[model samples]
Target chain A: MLHFKAEIKENIPVSKNHYLLTFTPLAKTPVPLPGQFYMIGIGNSCDPLLKRPFSILTKSDDSIRILYRIKGKGTTLMKEMKTGTVINVMGPLGNSYPIPKKKHTPLIIAGGIGIASVFYLAEKLKGKAIVLYGARGKHELLMLDELRGLVKELHISTDDGSYGKKGTIIDLLNEFHVNDKHLIYACGPKGMIRAVSEFALEKGLKGYISLEENMACGIGACMGCAVKTLKGYKRVCKEGPVFNIKDILW
Target chain B: MNLEVSIGKLRLKNPVMTASGTFGYGEEYSDFVDLNSLGAVVVKGISLTPMQGNPPPRICETPCGMLNAIGLQNVGLKKFLKEKLPYIRNFDTKLIVNILGSTVNEYVRLASALDEARVDGIELNVSCPNVKKGGIAFCADSRTLGRLVSKVRKSVNHSTLIVKLSPNVTDIKEPAKAAEEAGADAVSLINTITAMAVDLKTRKPVLKNITGGLSGPAVKPIALRMVWEVSRTVNIPVIGMGGIMNAEDALEFMLAGATAVAVGTANFINPSSTSDILEGIKIYMKENKINDISEIIGGLLIDNPDD
Candidate 1:
């Protein structure tokens, strides 16, 4: 609920048009939860009045980082934002992933850009997590070394065989020996989520999935980002951008 | 500072108003904002009876705007008066009820009910573009628009009646003049424009309703143009709104001849936008040495209509 003029610390192009922009908050940064997101805007264009939601990549005192891909006009403009330029940043909004108790082993699965949210989750669960990541190619598979440093084991998969296993991330997860003793967390393409959701259910594993939707108010007011669930359609920005894999209708 | 504003004889605590539909009866945003700071809250479009509204995929994003096919989804007038009005009155802000009816009688009935409830004002929402029936949206035609307003005017004795005009018409001035001729106390112009979006992969319209009203920064220019046009065409005060996200945008609407502007899609971006716009207006007024906000109404100089 606070709007601070943040200065861009760096905007690094990762692969193709994807970028990781780090910003220094002009105000006291709220302690955000894992899997939570922030709404960011470029300049003063009401054309994109609504802020673009980016997952909290990582955070430090007085600063926060966001990883985004150039998908549309808003992201395109965001890529051009120069270092030292100030932009409006709001929130550590939406619910975060629930943390596990002592000595809990959690399996984290992510696909492509979905890896952004899980990076922080791995950092939060350091030494007590296993990571399974998938991307289209070697270059698209990001944060492997960083995640490898934190997890007990890091599993990798690529569609083009340019990386570890030659199949979807779900394929890699299926190949790996995982049991009900471990809790699972995933974020990525809807197709991948649908695939892995079945695997989690078959194993009777408790898991959480982060869903993406075209949002108006990142807050609860608009009701623009309602996702169909087992109970009913709920606001993705409020009731959850994160939900139990079992609660999801997909 | 006493930050209240007035719409004709009705006094508002501030110049911030919740545009119709987006605020959902002022009860929804109460948790996020102080209702008293707002000039007035215009609730969702009300019909004679309950409406289920269009099916989903009711909203889609365009270039800079979003198309919504809420279908004037309302709780009807009787339920609104019996349940909704009392709750709204409990809030510390002025409530300007927005009414939509398919016939003149329905409009009169809805307006009379609001008068009986002793609400602040009636914003005749005759310009709803999401309906498929005749008389459901009277502002599309000059004669029907006049008839609807006149009927409500005759029935409501004390409340100020405003005819909200439609932007879907060829000439917005025609309807504004019609409402004024029919004895409307004031007029608001430029409701959402008729629009549709497509899903390229599915080869189908993105929205389930096929067509929806477009709003946000994309519609600001067109809204301002129509507000300027309608302000010149009619004698009544014009409350202009469309894509007003900041003080500058609000001032643009005022300069285009809107005495006060309503914040719609911008509210979706920031829950505190209404209060922000009100504060922004005050800053602009002090910086420019302007005492009254009405001085800025219709301040934009147009050498020719073609511009």
Candidate 2:
């Protein structure tokens, strides 16, 4: 991948602890895929040495948008970054989400912060999908308008009953009663993935899960993010940050 | 506009040198960086024999740095001379070989093999934190450090030898003095400090190796302090490093008694850190109206207890 000193064009709050960052690259670089991530540095502060990895929420010819939550020092620094400030970025790394060939009934499930990945996925497959989004409350329910515009059937559920259906996102998924003919995709907290993975497995539905781990060198060289699977320990950064539901051990 | 540095008799066009281990044999970063523009490329720590290094989870992120426990994973001196050294010779920049050994004899053997090759210099990697044996073992005692350097010194005639010191010791001066007495032409300090990152949730050590060397901007202050201390202790030229990301930081090392500086963890964060530091140093010199940076060596005033 090529390293570009990018300038921040926009930074806006999408939800609590989450913001959308748009960067304009200085040079021509590789276009980011739906699930691919970028390693970004916010400022010259000593708190962050390496760039923080973020999912490519959207991509265009010259600019790339990253959706991230203010969880740690790196993200906090990123939150403070002003528009027009330059930061170093090296990425469009990791594997992308598999694109569906035919227009199968698309079933998109997002848990809590997991909604970030589906932004780009929905942007690509707009008007031909169904989105089931779950969050703790209305404030945490991110990109609802965007997802609603993209999908045909939009289902919203909050744990605190602040949104459409008062229950867990998975609870709402169980009530959908969709047939096994649909292709499913999901991202969110680990617990949500395990729940959705088990549910999708029993229902005999085709689904993919975007997993998360604390990665040092987000490339394969570090081998920090190892997930147990049928093929033994596989690197999440290389093998599959996005794995088919059946491939996951949990 | 070609900037280079000469460590003793060996000459490097640019003062920007890649610290060992972060750069894998001067080849890993070639795709991202112009290897020839660098002052020198020091490969990973090579032992007398091949090493597997530590188990999985070899690295972890610290406050503003990284802890790495890659226990000198190399193909040994024989393989290096046969394979790695020949390929490096084809490049334009200087190649400094960082060697780690278990004993004095092993250091001698490694040095002898390096002397036979077309390499520019040898940086005795006596401070690698990854290995439990032969790496930091040589740097613990001044007497042993001197003996290790002397053995390598006597073995190699053509190559300039630099003894890299560890920061884990109580007093850095003792080892710096010992290396000087052993006829080391130059010295580089400090290597990563022994550190461990614990997962608060799991209540277990983050890295598989319980301990690893900490590097990056987090260690910059500590490295600068040690460089200042070691430079004052030894008369030989000192190559300073640890957490240096920019030219101002590199200049800080130079002012604190380092003849040159190495950019390690910064390379992981920014591919252009080395070049940026080089450019910054030149611009700093121009802005400060300083013709030569050599005038600023040991510029810090020693704190006075009885003023």
Q: How would you encode candidate 1's per-residue C-alpha lDDT over A89-149 as one tens digit per residue?
A: 7778889999976655888989999989888998998778888899999999777777788
Error of 2 at B304 (Å): 11
The interface RMSD values of the models, given in order, are 3.1, 3.7
Residue-by-residue lDDT tens digits, candidate 1, B250-280? 9898888887789999877677789888889
Candidate 1 chain B least-lDDT 10 residues: B132-141
Models 1 onward score TM values of 0.84, 0.78
DockQ (0 to 1) for model 1: 0.24
User: Highest TM-score: which candidate?
Assistant: 1
Top model number, lDDT: 1
**C-alpha lDDT (0 to 100) for residue B156 of candidate 1:** 82
At residue A164, candidate 1 shows an lDDT of: 91
Task: For each candidate in the order shown, give its overall lDDT on alpha carbons.
Answer: 0.81, 0.80
